[model samples]
Target: MHIVIIGVGGVGGYFGGKISNSNQKVTLIARGKHLEAIQKKGLQVKSINGDFITHPFLATDRIDIVEKADLVLICTKSWQVPEAAELVKPILKEDTIVIPLQNGADNAEKVSTVLGVKHVLGGLCRIYSKIEAPGVISHFGHQPDVVFGELDKSKTNRLQKVKEVFDQAGFNNSISGDIEVDIWSKFMFITTVSGLGALTRVTIGEMYENKGTRHVLEQTATEIYKVGIAKGVSLPEDIVDRIMTFIGKQPYESTASMQRDIMEGRPSELDNFNGFIVKEGIKAEVLTPVNTFIHSCLQPMEAKARI
Candidate 1:
């Protein structure tokens, strides 16, 4: 199968690098110094599981030349999903399968708005990795797992084919029973930590260890849970508690990708994370005061980054 990985950041780089080791053809859409480095020196993955390097069949910034793909993995930030979809639209074959393995809850929906629902799938990834340098990805923690399925949850031949590809590539992947619930479970956790972590400008340990910030964190998760429930996602009643337990087990130095983006003064998923929850809350008649506060507080920085 031919696969194109868009936005070769932490998620894309790691997974794409893994797939490159297999017999399947792989192309990576990347940008700036990262793309340059990948084209010249190959993509390097320093993984907790192991370290390896593989040069893809092609790595380019041009979306047009990647005119055909059996599968397209959208790994861009949540806010960029629609833009990415538009860029990749002409390249999609009728049978092309696109999965948004992004942090935001509505990335698949956002892509569907551009590429149509028939071409999109729901996907979420569990990994904490980042670009350590140009063309170099560092997987510092967590066993990387990619969960995905058709939006309608149908068990189809194509779905099995995608799963087989990942399995062949030696990735820990599974077809989710309920992709929506799986996406929300990830959204609830990432959104809970991201905004507060960005605002406080602290590591996860520092944010949770401080009494005041811990309260904010809890409230943030609460707001997300309320919004998810209002939106009819099958988020469990104990999701917030479960997330807290998960957070507690995380390494103290751990931080979210959105938090890192904001701290580094890059454009972030602020709109897609807290801002998304706030908007959905209003639509669902759910109160998301904590998210609203975080969104408001971070707006200036977010705006300035774009400038």
Candidate 2:
């Protein structure tokens, strides 16, 4: 099976490296210094589970150069998915499976708008990781978990095949029975903390330590939950509590990639995360005051960063 990975940052690099090491025909599509580093040396992954290096069958920025791809993992940022979809469209074969492991609720929708439904899958990953260097991924926190399935949430042979590949790669994974709920479940948790993390400029531990801050987290998650439930996602009633417990388990110094991007004066998923909840809330007639507040606070910086 030939697997192609787009945007080889933390998510793509770590998972793609593992798949490549499993001896699959893996191709990495990346650009700039990271691509240079991988082309010269191999992709390096430093993980808590263990460290390993993998030289993919091919690593190039040009998608057209890839002769064939059976599976394409779109690991780009939420906002970049559409553009990535455009670039990788030329390489999509008859049976190529494109799964997006971005940290947002609507990533699959974004990709499908460009690549069509047959080639798209809804997926999300849970891991506190980032690019430690060019072509190097650092998995410093979280037991990396991946959840994915067909957009329609049907049982199929393709789903099982994808699961087998993930099993071989050796990370924690599940073929979600209801991928929408799974995607929103991760979205609820990530959106609950990500915007607040950026606004407060505090680590996950710092926010969890403050009683008042913790209250805000609850409010944020609750607002997001209402929006998701209103949109017919059927998230559990105890989702906020469950997410709070999950946040408590994160490393003391852990910060989400979106939060780190904002802190470093880089463009972030402000629109895709908090801003997304705000938009969806409006569409669903669900109140999202807390999310609106967070989005409002960060819009200027986000706009400036884009400039």
Candidate 3:
């Protein structure tokens, strides 16, 4: 199967490299120095599980140069999903499967709006990785896990095929029975810490170390839980507690990509993360004061980066 990975950052590079190494036909879409590096050498994955490098079947910035793909993995930042979908549309066959492994809750919806529901799948990934340098992915923590499924929950041959491919590539992946809940479940955990992490400018460990900050983090998570529940997502009542325990168990030095982006003065998923919760809360009549506060605090810097 020919696979095209849109946005070869941490998520795309690591996963794509693994797939390509398994002798699958994989094409990577990246730009600038990272693209140059991959073209000259190869995509490198420095992973805790194992480190390996594989040259993809193709790596190019221009989507037009890619082959018509059987699957398109949309791994771009949340804000870039729509435009990236449009760019990759030209290379898609009607039966092509497009799965978005992004952080935001509404990524599939965003991609579906551009590529249509027939070609889109609801998906989320659990991994802590980022670009250590051009064309190099550093997977520091968490055994990579991917969850994906059809929007309508029908068990199609394509879903089974994709799962088989993931299995063949030695990935811990699942086809979710309810993709929406899975997406929101991951969203609840990520949104709970991401904005607060940015605002505090600390690692997850440091944030929890301060009792006061930990309290804020708990509240932030609770607000997101409320929003998820209000949106009719099947969120368990103990989600916040469960996530808190999970957070405490993670590497204390671990930080969300959004936090690092904000710290480095790059545009982040501020609007997509905390800002999303705030908007959903308003629509759902759920109170999200903590999220609003975090979003408001981070707005100026986010806007400045865009300017």
Query: What is candidate 2's lDDT per residue for 169-237, written digit by digit as tens?
Result: 998899988999999989988888899999999998999999998999999999988998888887989
Q: Rank the candidate models, highest TM-score first.
A: 2, 3, 1
Mind giving the per-residue lDDT tens digits that candidate 1 earns over 1-307?
Answer: 8999998999999999999977679999999999999999999999989999898999999887775999999998888888888988878898999999989999999889899999888999999999999999999988999999888878878889899889989989999888998899889889989999999888888887888888888899888888888888888889889888787777899999999999999999999999999999999999888899999999999999999
lDDT, residue 217, candidate 3: 86
1 or 2, which is superior by TM-score? Answer: 2
Q: Could you tell me which 10 consecutive residues in candidate 1 have the lowest summed lDDT?
A: 242-251
Give a tens-digit lDDT track for model 3, residues 156-231. Answer: 8889989988987898999988899888878877887799999988899998888998899899989988988888
| Model 3 worst lDDT window (10 residues) | 184-193
Better of 1 and 3 by lDDT: 3
- Model 1, global lDDT: 0.91
Which residue pairs clash within candidate 3? none
TM-score between candidate 2 and the true structure:
0.98
lDDT of 2 at 3: 88
Superposed by TM-score, candidate 1 places the C-alpha of residue 140 at a distance from the truth, in angstroms, of 0.8
